[model samples]
Target: MIVFDLACQPAGHRFEGWFGSSEDFAAQKERGLVACPQCGSHDVEKAVMAPRVGRKGNQSGTRNATSPARTPVASEALPPEVAQAMQKLARMQGEALKNSRWVGDDFAEQSRAMHYGERERETIHGEATAEEAHALIDEGIEVAPLPFPVAPPDETN
Candidate 1:
C-alpha cells in the first residue's frame, strides 16, 4: 500500500490517503473519486513532498515523507452574501479567542478536562493534533478546530 498526501483544490484542508499504487491514485483522481474528507472536495492532487535525509545510524538512506494535503476553495467564487457570512464567522471566532487563554499545545487535554469537569469551563483555543481531535470527538467532548492556524503566544513576541 502506498500513502499519498492529497490536497483538494478550490479550501486547503490537507489529508492523507492510501492507494494500491501510484497508478491507482491517478485513476481515482481522474475519476474524481478522491475527495477531501474535511470539505468533500473532489479537486484533489498530490501534495508537495518534502525531502528528507537519512541519519548515519539509519540503514536505508531513503525515506518517505508525507504532508497533510489541503483543499483549496476560491473565496472569490462564492456569492457575496456567503463570503460575507464566512468573514463574519471568522471574525466572531477571532473575537471569541481574543480574551480566551492560549493553551498552546495543550488544547486537547485542556478541552477534555473541561468536558469532564476536571477543569472549569472557560474560553480557550490552541493546537491539537488531528488524531487528538479525533480522540476528543470519540470521547464525546465538544471541540471544534480553528479555521485558521494561530501563532503560539510565545512566538508572537
Candidate 2:
C-alpha cells in the first residue's frame, strides 16, 4: 500500500490516502471516489510532503528552539461549522454502532450469509479488506464503510 498526503479544495482539510499505486490514486480521484474524510469533498489533491529521512545515528535527539512546532488542534485547524458537523457525525456513528453487532473479521462471511438468506439479517459491523468489500458489492450485496474506525469489542478497555 502507498500513502499520499491529500488536501481537500476550499476547506483544505489535510488527510492521508492509501492506494495500491499512484495510478490507483489518480483513477479514484478521476472517478470521484477520492473524498476528504473530514468534509466528504471529492475535490481532493495531493499535498506537498517532505521526504521522510531518518536522523544520523550519531546526531543529538534534541530539537532546537527555532524548530517548527506541531500541527494545531483539530478545532483550530477547521472552521467552526465544519468542526461542529464533524462532531455531530461522530456522535451519530457512535449511536449507530450501539445498535450494531461487532462481527469482528467475519464481516464478509456474515454479510454474504445474510445476503443469501443463510443467516438472519441484523445490524452488523466489522472489518473487511478492500477486495472483499468489492467482491461483496459485485455479488449484489450492499455494504458500506463506517465513517469512523471502530475498535473490536475485545480490544476496548
Candidate 3:
C-alpha cells in the first residue's frame, strides 16, 4: 500500500489516503471514488509531502523529546496481531452494515429526518460532510465515522 496526503479542492480539507499504488489512486480518482471525508468532495488533489526516510540501524543520535517521532509507512509489513485486529475490525464493520440502508449523499438529511421524528429510525450508513456530522452531534444525534471507507453499492463491481 502507498499513502498520500490529499487535500480537497475549495474546502482544502486535508487527509491521508492509502492506495495499492499511484495507478490505483488515479483510477479511483477518475471514477470519483476518492473523495474528501471532511466535505464529501471528489475534487481532491495530492498535497506536497516531505519524504519519510528512516535512519540506518547503526545511526545513533540524540533526539529532542519535543521532536516528533517518524510514523511508520503504510507499505511496511505489519505485526501479525495488528493485521489480525484490522481484519477483525473490517469484519465487524461489514456485519454491522449488513442490515444498514445506504442513503448515499443524503446521509445528513436522512439522519436529521430520523432524529426529528420525520422519518422512522433505522440503521443507515452513508456519506456526510464533517460539518454536517459535527452539527448532528451538536444536535444530540448519534453518528460515527466508519473505520474504513465503504464503496457505494452503485459503484461496486
Instruction: Return the candidate ranking by TM-score, descending.
Output: 2, 3, 1
Positional deviation of 26 in candidate 2, in angstroms? 13
lDDT, candidate 3, equals 0.86
Computed on alpha carbons, the lDDT of every model, listed in order, comes to 0.76, 0.85, 0.86
Which candidate number would show the highest lDDT if scored against the true structure? Answer: 3
CA lDDT, candidate 1, residue 25: 87
* lDDT, candidate 3, 8-120, per-residue tens: 99899888999999998986676467887656688999999987677889878777689999987655466677678779999999999999999998999999999999989
Worst 10 residues of 2 by lDDT: 71-80
Q: List the residue pairs that clash in candidate 3.
A: none
lDDT of 1 by residue, 1-157 (tens): 8888888887887888898999978765654457776666878888987743447774655544574556786433656776687689889877987889998779889998899899899988887666787898999988775654466778876
Model 2: lDDT equals 0.85
Best by TM-score: 2
> Of models 1 and 3, which has the larger lDDT?
3
Cand. 3 TM to true fold: 0.57
RMSD, every candidate, angstroms: 11.8, 5.5, 13.3
